[model samples]
Target chain A: MTARPFHRSQAEMLPERAAPVTTAGVVGWLRANLFSSWANTAFTLIALYLLWLIVPAIADWAYFNADTAGDDRFACKSSGACWAWVDQRIGQFLYGFYAPDQTWRVDLAVVLLIPALAPLLFEGVPFARQLRWFSLAYPVVATFLLVGGIGLEGIPTDKFGGFMLNLTVGLAGIVLSLPIGILLALGRRSRLPIIRILCVGFIEIVRGVPLITLLFVSNIILPIFLPPDVTVDSLIRVIVMVTAFASAYMAEVIRGGLQAIPRGQYEAAQALGLRYWQSMVLIILPQALKISIPGIVNTFIGLFKDTTLVIIIGLFDILGIGNAMVSNPDWLGLATEAYVFIAFFFFIACFSMSRYSIHLEKRLDTERRD
Target chain B: MARNASARRPGSPGWQRLWSDERTRGLIYQLLVILGVALFVAFIVSNTIANLQRAGLASGFGFLFDQAFFDINQRLIDYTSTSTFGRALVVGLLNTVLVSAMGIVAATAIGFVAGVLRLSPNFLLSRLVGAYVEITRNVPVLLQIIFWWVVLSGLPKVRDSLALGDAVFLNNRGVRLPAPLFESGFEWVLAAALAGVVATVFVARWSRRRQNESGERFPVFWSGLALIVGLPALVYWIAGSPVAWDIPKPTRFNFRGGFNVTPELVALWIALSTYTGAFISEIVRAGILSVSKGQTEAAGALGLRPGQTMWLVVIPQAMRVIIPPLTSQYLNLTKNSSLAIAIGYQDLVSIGGTILNQSGQALEVVGIWMVVYLSLSLLTSMFMNWYNRRIALVER
Candidate 1:
């Protein structure tokens, strides 16, 4: 009422203005991410061009022009991939020569792995203590289910082949290698010169040679080293060799973890009058193992991929089975399809395992920060 | 108290002292370990002797001198089917060296490019590079080797080769590239190139000193490149260009005249390099990232351009983090080259495997494999250590 409402004492809020289209929408995101500069725009164009060159061709070959619904090679007529070979041999690829009736046992063993791994891998599983007991007994149960003993009809070792063989060897190696690796790592770090030297020697020798040579040793030389009266199964021999190889690598990884722990932790344990094993078990190992989880997982992935090397020693793993399939007259030219199928299997297995490791690492990082 | 003290002395009950005294306990444990190892060795030795005798296999290096009748498709040296097993092994060793060296070169080039591209500011390029790394690394290398072999062998027949001009040809048999035929005067060109390199090194040192004193920059890199290339060209001109190309000529069933790179070599080379390159790219990315952002900012504050900052501030620091793992990657490539056996690439292990089967000398053959590989590993690490020391940071 004085001069005007313009000079009013009460303030009114103004409406929020919209961000400019150039900086705050889909177009803005494209500009920021792909066309931030002249060089970046050019790169984006080139990348798109390259992807255009590769992606559609692969899709056409793998899907559009591909023939997957076939019982034999002759049923495939596409200029692209012939996946009929993969289709017909899928069972053999998975179970090898495992009896068709006993295939359920292999499937059960594989399914049991999830529950066995759950308590060890995750923090909030129900009845985790009881699950830990199952985790401890998983190897025995898996062995009985797959290999058979104690009321189960036994499957001969030769029947174990294909991807089942890979999973069995890899899982067994991963399970057995950890405790041995821990012992070796401790030995390498031991105050006693003899123990340290022996551990160091074992690790260096194993790591220095190729796994192929070790497999050769297992195939031809291991039997020579053993007593003649005690004939170990070839599968068992391979598992033993693979475990030794992985454990040597695992020892070095664990040693890195052991070294990373602050010296004060050990001193503190000693101050509490804890003996060597007690300090290691109660105070040291948990922290070291947590730090080394990524490395442990990496070693497991490597060992799993390396199970393919058993094919070199003439064991019929998945790759071996794939090779055998491709050589058949019905699938003579289907090597590409066979190899791609096998590669896809490995990629899925390894990629998921690596992702899990990264997840665990992030969790550990958050816990440490807290 | 006196009895307790006396019990702790040297005259105590042996078993009690062994169990109670820490020093004695450690000594006993070590002795036990040694004895156990000795017993294990004795058992293995006794068993091996019996087994070898039963199998009627000769043991020792004696078999190495015997004739290796098997033919190796890819041999680096002059070895026929008539060659001794040792010569065949030497040929295999050379082949291994050839592939490893070539694979190392290609892997380094691919790794550096992929690693830098993975961190590109352009989002799409980075994602593409990331995809390449993930897909290549996760797949089994043996499968990759076999896959590549299949791909290579699936190429068109020699009669239908995909020719690049008259100088290069590609087919199922492999690549046929024009080989340079050096005449008498070519040595002078090589000498000139060597001289240019030596001169360039001196000039670089001189230019660096001049920069320190006068703050005037010399274009050392451009000048060095010009010298290396220009001097060689000049010499070649003066020597009448004593080089000729041996381009491939298509024959009835194959190509001749050019250098024939076998399909097995191509497959092994591509697979090993690509596989190891993925690992190396990851190493390189980690190395580069370990160089902090503050470094670039600090360099910028000091008025260095972005390229200069990368060259002078980032890369030098990053290299220290890179070299150790790079050495390991190199060793891995060398070791993985032994996977040549899977695809019949005629590497040391493949030849050795053949020899092992022929001679039935598993012990000796395995021993040779271990010794040679161990030595190779040791030699590589030693060289890498030297290089690392030369580039190491100097601290007061």
Candidate 2:
């Protein structure tokens, strides 16, 4: 036999002895992750110290010592937090000044939103193609339910407030801005120079300025520009301005998607004797929109958050309702509680949307890879 | 004969040919758009004129020169209620610039630290940082501003100020800090600092050249730090340390005379920094992740330390990914500063609102706001683009 250059473990495989304590299991993980070096040890200790300092205090204030129920400040005897104010005004926070009896309409509309969004946000749902028709008509039905149309009792726009108003403005803007945004995106890339310039100019100007300024324009300047006898509803005006602002941003996002389409794809469509719009609708836009779903969702989240800006112009969204509640004599000095409550609502809405977008991105990425 | 009849001829009628022609269709479409736009503009102009006349509101910008009767709580420049509306607006703009600049600096610092720490080997630290990013980002910034405002305003009363080592004070009113009273010869110390910066730059260049030539590595960081600190110190000592402290002292009701940071500024500054910092941190994390793991392994194989690998191999590549989004975040922070109005921080939009109400020149005031913001956005984007181009990778 040839002499072995290296020794080999040939004694019954050494009975498969376990790894040493220092290099195995929990101790090994700790050594590798948290105390691999002096700096890492220090970082871990500092993090622990910081958590020790902050977490308990926050937990105590927000939960352990907190007053969770009551009607007013007197009910909150604890020094931690006065959540009683939030508890008392939860209705106003949810439905604003809407008549309590009519809140069922708002509730129904909100419930319908799930089905309306399901077909768009997910794949493989039952009868998704048929459900899209409901999605298309859902916006109108929801509006009618909330606003009181042909068959329902009349509810003026002024009466709209609270979280309901936020959903209204955000959903309406999302639905309305898309078509306009698509057109603007096409316009910006059109063969006609004037259309491109006009589209570019509108987008830049709107994006450069804050939403507050546009709201101000709608509040004060829009009236001056309209005909003397033609008075538009304030909520409608807000919706119009919001749509304009959102469409500008949306157009940019869609344009990014449009630009990403390979020249070969356009050529392929053209070679098949398709008209411009037909090619866009049948081939390009479907792929482009799928690619831009994450961006569109992000824009929607931004628009949803921006609905709070209407408070600055004197319309009471959820934040406005919270602010107004805080200023009430019975709830004075409860701004923290009010803001926290409103922030929690917004956080839930925005965070879930972001999470969904990330999930969709991953799914789309896998699909593309496949 | 049928095919010939169906086929378009060169002698076809002009109207029919023009109708069918793509180029002519485009031209006609553009002309219609122009005409429609002109008519719309004319209608708006006519209605606006009629409305202005009807309301008896003057439309000129002359109101800018009129006295602003309202008191601005946080003016960076010299201003009183008697100051012109223009001066008040200038004060507002300066305040906005101050908050935005400070917020940007603080946000960047926090963002970089949190981002790196979040990717640390220590699981607790990373999770903590992740939580911070998610919670802060998901919350609306307006609510944060108001929350901070309320928290700051709910601090101990002026009489029971929270003192910090006898130099800083905090109360419901705001933070009070000792102001530096600069005397003569401080300019010499400033000059020394400037000279030290120049010298450090030169030394860095020299060291780089030396390294390239002879494979020598200089202690550039320590030497640069020494130069910057030592020169300033020497000058300060020679100039007799011409700076005195003006520490705030508690009086009957409020702190007496040092420097006062109003609650509005404090609240707005803190909220903007924290909120924007969360976003910036995510951008930084993404950028760092975009730099492949192969880079770190390669640096290790080349015998570079972990720190050196991060600084030299990873960060340079990461910066390219970080910068563009970072620029947008900066812009977002600047624009979000307009929300300062919500908490009475008296930024440009707030001041403009007051001016609009007082002067009734809504159009001009809004016009000024649009122009100013547009220019600010343009200038920031231009500067950031230049910086981005300078650091971009040179492809082979």
Candidate 3:
């Protein structure tokens, strides 16, 4: 029976059938995606030539001719980037003039943060439920470690100057803005007209102006509104303004999440005899916030990048510190080098946040589909 | 509004809701919020006045009339150190608008082209576009501004400027280019061009109506373009070519007679366009992708050529998804133009910062900033919304 069947179709039993010239393997893929037409071929060639020109120059600058481990700019003067400058002042770039001995405090804060944040960020991590308490306590503990108050030797606001300061602003803004943003989102959706109007006004006004102007309010104008007995320092005021700015953005993001929820869910919660707060806390917010994770992270990234604006008001974030370093007589013309180093710092932070957000999006997407 | 079935009429005792009622609680909460807000604002205001008094700084717009001793490097209008502070601000505002408006046009052009390329059926080219987007978006734009500033400023000195033919020169100082000096009677050509544009719109409308009524497709695009270009040229010839070129000539240290654009402006423009273009490209890619493959298949089934399908079937649908985000990008570009201050470009924020520091009228300066920015935002959003409605989906 097998012999009869094999003989029935000679073509099937013969050697493997050949795919068409234009539809088989890598060559076919190249023809289909890159060189199917004259326009596409020309584009491919042009892009290849461009890469040829740029890649070599960048590689030569960043690697081939790049100097490392030396502190002297005079010793490393090439047509390429002066990476040696970056190596010499890495500490200043990271800590921004925080007393050298106090660098450990900054390290401690970061060390504590990893475990606290990991559970929340990764679903597969162990003891995520119990770790929620760690997440809640992290901000206070980190802040105390950073600024040094109550028990530790206090690092004055002025001494807080570098990339460490950027972290401070970003973390404070992220943590503070989350709750304020949720409240604002709920307020905007409130049945009460006044509350809705107030929320809308705050969101619009804050959103309308640029963040630099808001920082100006914190730097130059906030003290004018404070009582004589109350002394609010620059860092605290800037944090407050940063938090406000972040909340406006986060509010809009959460509002989008709230809007995506079907009307049936709200009705179902009401039918269950849940009060407004109860319905929101127990039902609406959880689902809405779950969907909003990507958006919230996106806002956080924006807030982190925006810490650079603090430099406009003369605060020394990482970039500000880099700028200050370049102004040194020792590194006279190394602005390009210093700025490149600073850019790498930002690129890593932003890239990872964006990647994590995308990962969460994909993970959540499958769960939703199921 | 109808009363709930379980509730009594307003006149009855049961009609009066309990304190536990949600509506009553909501009202009470709103009342408390309003009161708290009012009290907070009053407190801030009182403290501000007390502080202002202690500082002995007069709060007024009259400072705007005072002579601005500060010299503006780049001025579109006639101004000097003696110009009023208000005038300097006007110049600064004009500078800001000029950059943002021109930056918007350039960014949109670059973004659209890059976006189209990002979706090209080419692998390497698409990857190149992807790399561009990732690199631009990942690094802080401020760093880009600084990098570009250094690059432009590192150009040769004025005496050793890079000459591109005779009309343009690039140097550390600026790029000088030949400016068009419109002679007398040039306005007629401009008028003709405007008339041609108006006529083209009418013809397009007429063609569309005819196609709708009789299924007769007119050759509108080509003929309209010819009319617009040819009509203006014909008028220019009739008017004896009334325009002159003010070519810059090389002097000992610099070029003379032509216009100069500063390195600051160039750096800011390039950085802003490149940065904003990255985001715009993503929007464009998403817009194009949102049009499902079935759309193109359906177009093919209906006997539309590839190009026609692109124009008629694909682009129209894609634009619906594109424009709202595009409006926000425009708003963002305008706001981010505030970064122009970092590079010493005299934008509104920069000018305001100057006035604030010089006059120390923090309250008034901040107020002006709020008002101008808020108004600009409102007007832009309103215009975008109106445009959206005009082109929104209309069901049959």
**Candidate 2 second chain TM:** 0.94
Residue pairs with clashing backbones, model 1: none
Q: lDDT per model, in order? A: 0.90, 0.90, 0.87
- Model 1 spans with C-alpha error above 4 angstroms: A1-14, B1-18, B204-218
Count clashing pairs, candidate 2.
Answer: 0
A183-260 per-residue lDDT for model 1 (tens digits): 999999999999999999999999898888998998888888887888888898899999999999999899989999
Which candidate wins on lDDT?
A: 1
Query: What is the number of backbone collisions in each predicted candidate, taken in the order shown?
Result: 0, 0, 0
Winning model by DockQ:
1
Error of 1 at A159 (Å): 1.3
lDDT digits (tens) for residues A188-273 of candidate 2:
99999999999999999998988888999999888889988998888888888888998988898999999999999999999999
Candidate 3 per-residue C-alpha lDDT over A128-150 given as tens digits, one digit per residue, 9 for 90 to 100: 88788989889888878888988
Evaluate residue B184 in candidate 3 and report its C-alpha lDDT on the 0 to 100 scale. 90
In angstroms, how far off is B290's CA in candidate 1?
1.0
**Between which residue pairs do clashes occur in model 3?**
none
Per-residue lDDT of candidate 2, residues B280-359 (tens digit): 99899999999999999999999999889998889999999999989988988998899999999989999999998988
TM-score of chain A of each: 0.95, 0.93, 0.93
Error of 2 at A14 (Å): 6.8
Kindly report which residue stretches of model 3 are placed more than 4 angstroms away from their true locations once superposed. A1-22, B1-17
